[model samples]
Target: MIAPVVSAPTVSRGVRLGYGVGSFCTATVNAVPGLLLLYYMTNFLAVPAWLAGVVVTAPKAWDLIINPLVGRWSDRTRSRMGPRRPWLLAGACTLPIAFFLVFAGPPLTGVPAALYVGACFMATATAYALFEVPYKAMPGEMTHDYHERTSLLQWRMIFIGAATAISGVLAPAIVSSQGANGTVGSYRLMAATIAVILLVAMFGSFFGTARAPMTGAPEADRGGWREQFAAIKGNSAFIWITALACTQMLAVSMMLAAAPYFAAYTIGTPAATQTLFAALVGPMLLTMPLWVRLSKRFGKRGAMVLAALLFGGGTAAAVATPLFGPLYAHLTILVVGVGIAGVQLLLFSMLADVIAADAARTGKRRAGVLTGLWTAIESGVSSFGALIFGVILSLGGFIESEPSTPVQQPDSAVTAVLIGQTAVPAVIIFASVLMTLKYRLTPPVGPGPDESG
Candidate 1:
């Protein structure tokens, strides 16, 4: 049977723009540590590779338990400000503080450093969860109009692309300018800047969108924990989408984790590294409109398939860097970036679609639960990617000593880094592409209350 269509409140152009900005700031804060933390730990702070990986991965692991609980809480929260905004505001307030602390570089050695990093990371992760789960859940709550949803996502992608591109390019330059002693200082500055941006964006989003009129509590709302488990277990579409998201994140995280190493060792110049990042992210900003149009024309599934294929092909080409010169490597990486642009842009859009569909089918808006689960899964995959990359570097016999030249690293170590960047992610991304074939949910064509009954 066809589900009932829920009429979502009309979001103004200003509100949409505000949400887009908020998304961009959020992406910046999220991307920075993943992009630079490993390099900071191993090369700058003289931490061992394995230990660095542990620091990066372990704290985020907490999300596995916390995400669902947060989701359930948000789903049931009955507040004057609305269910999602409170958490968003709280996260915004605390996130930057935790972010600064993570990079503040306490003068500790050995186990002390590890413990400090882990605790700081855990705090950041928790704060991120508070913000991210609600923010992600917003799209599904914002409007049920299929075309409007697509438009909203289009705006989101535009800002997200811009933020990622700007931050990706500027971060290295900022770190370099702070002098040799400025790695920690640079990170602090970046965190502070990002925190401000995050705050402004989130505040805007919180005030911008009107809360959906929630009609009733979900079945899991009154049930015990077992009932919640049952609810999650029965939601096959959510399960598949979450799994796909996790795998895709694994691929992205692995590439992000290894990017600095590849730039330093493979391309041999910090300038080249910065340029490579620009080349990778720059096209995305320009192409978001095109991607949005494509998603509408081809439908989300077809668009994702095309995107995944492009990503996989481009990534595989990156693996061929050893066979070519630095120019070829840079070009290949840029190509991979183009593919990533489409994937990154569409994945969240598709998730929004899926969540809306699930609500329609279940007669309950569980955007929070779905987003929470997604956040948890993404955290695990991200952590696993970091851990695995570290293990690989450790196994490859990479040393933490500064190299006089980029090419000075052992051939095996360079190869390992390259493999981590390209070959490993390509495999996971390809699998995710195959899995997207099973995503059969479509945008409903009528207007009514969102129904899952």
Candidate 2:
């Protein structure tokens, strides 16, 4: 059954913060796996690049099926604690365990090791879908106000950036610090720590949003997955925005997979990988308000256009790569950082609106189902980031050596790293600008897009 939109009667700051902290879990799972899993498999475990990519991407095909099922289940659930939080709590408890095993591997080598990673990663991806699908659904149910939705997402993104820095950078640092990069012990220790953090943050969001309302009463009329899919198909804004988000995630994934390589070959400080990332993200943290203001003033699409321009410019600048040394390199990354901050900050808020609009248009409250697709696309694209990196490396003939030792890549591979980090993303992101230009979503409909064109 469709329900009338209901904005929050009162949304406490604590509730906002609690919800935001859940992103730490999201970022840890997303960033850590994206950043290091490829490195661990290819470089440390002696897995071939192409096969490693298959191990990474195949699980997400499973996620495409699992995400919608989980989403629909949450829609049908009738629980006092709310449909989303119970699942969030479940995911919080179990996700880290699978995450630990992804890195832990079995006590074997080669194909056996590949099987272990693929199996563990599938488990981890499922656990992520459990929390994230429902969690993504929450904002639509939690509030209907345009500005308020943006505020909630702002808090979430702050934690997301922090988690990216910690998970992406510090995890690699921990592995390298162990005297053997990506060593079994190093990954075990790192995974355990990340799992603990995921638990605290997920549980925090669960209890924090405990008092929030559901989207509607169990979606009685259009309760099936077929109905949910049809509802989403009606929303053009969601479609375009989803397209944009997928590409952005893919571009970001390529860079993340290439970060350590860029640092090693381009920046020439392999051990300072975390510091390099910090420079990119630190400005993102400090400059978020500017993006907030841009969205408020210029409209979200305009702001996204601005972000796309900055992203392109930064990627183009990356061609300079230490020619002007560390300062220039850092500044280029900083520009990219500011650009990404806008996308991350504005896009999720946009999705919440899309879900709301779909509910209103189709007269079926199916935020969970929509969000499941949203999260599924996100997780799937993220895994493909690794696949893309591995393909680029293989096509470029990248070398893998002992994690503790220096292995200089061939000039062709070095060029591939540069292309992955810069050119491919630049092209893909520029295309997003076209999609953003077509978006005209506003409060009357939602924040993502409303234009029939």
Candidate 3:
């Protein structure tokens, strides 16, 4: 028989803010690498585009193993600080240092440079899994109210927007300030600054949710990996959402990886990277409330379909950037940003619902394991965005060069950048819209439980 829903208390404002703060770390770490790392490897370090893509993607492949293990480890921990916070603390301590090293810009080029960046990035990915897998699991355990989950994640979406905007604008601006071509010294400075931000945000989140609620009892030593996989396989909602999220992430990653090339070749200025990112994220800050209300009116599945259409449409229209110029590209990306707001808000909220419902049905603490698997696949699939874009660049004969010695890209390479950034992503995002149609879930409901002290 199915267990009754265990009503969870509402999260307090301070705690909510603290939990939301973690996105500063998650968003920056994700955004900077996706936006600049590929360009950095190819342009600054002279790594071939294909090899650079491999370096960026190879480490995230480790996530498939590490994320689930971290998840299981967190699920079983008996900590006074709670199951997830200790891991958050651990990630806070490690990730910044690892991140700093990824862009330290060692005095090396080509293969050696690729190896160095790869090793450092692997470390970053591992540290990230420690925090993100368990961190994602928290909302499910925090509350059982279906609508409350959306309300709680709204704060997360807001923070995501802010963090993404800051990182997106700041990183490129720092790099561009050194030179239109960008020097190694400039990247080093950007990495160090971003690392400090990561430290503050990760630690803030570690302490912020000190008194956050948990709806279910801990199930440490619950079964082995086989059991976890079986549980995940049984959940249709989990599967569909994971598929949908992976497709969306891949599209976003591709656009991020191609941004610098798009700015330099299509938009006619290296600094346009900053403006494009600004356009891509500005709607996130302004339209979050609209997305939230839309979810309420149409339901998440319906809203998700609408959002995907907007994203796909905007991305497709951006293909005309070369013909219409920078203004057209920015306008199109602004529309993409509006859709992104809804897409980001609804996906996490839906995941929380799925996890909460699973707990109610089975009386098991599976959030960690489930989230572990979800993050693993998400990270792995998203890495392909860079890989795919790299292959496109290679096919178009993109030349590798040092920052001090800039190379003129062939017209084919420039064309590849435009298509990879816009058309490919547009196709992929529309495919995600089709996947969204397959997701079906009924939110769990019950009387409210007593508030956590």
Model number with the top TM-score: 3
RMSD of 3: 3.2
lDDT of 1 by residue, 111-175 (tens): 67767878988998898888888788877767766666777777887787777776677777777
Stretches > 4 Å off in candidate 1: 1-3, 6-9, 179-182, 210-220, 402-408, 445-453
As for candidate 2, its clashing pairs are 1-220, 1-221, 441-449, 441-450
RMSD of 1: 3.1
* Backbone clashes in model 2: 4
Assess candidate 3 and give its TM-score to the true structure.
0.96
Report backbone clashes per prediction. 7, 4, 0
Ranking by lDDT: 3, 2, 1
- lDDT score at residue 71, model 3, on the 0-100 scale: 90
User: Which residue pairs clash within candidate 1?
Assistant: 5-448, 6-450, 360-451, 360-452, 361-452, 362-452, 363-452
Candidate RMSDs in Å, in order, are: 3.1, 2.9, 3.2
Candidate 3 Cα misplacement greater than 4 A, ranges: 1-6, 444-453
For residue 244, what is the lDDT in candidate 3? 93
Candidate 3 — number of clashing residue pairs?
0
Give the range of the ten consecutive residues with the poorest summed lDDT in model 3.
444-453
Q: What is the C-alpha lDDT of each candidate?
A: 0.74, 0.77, 0.89
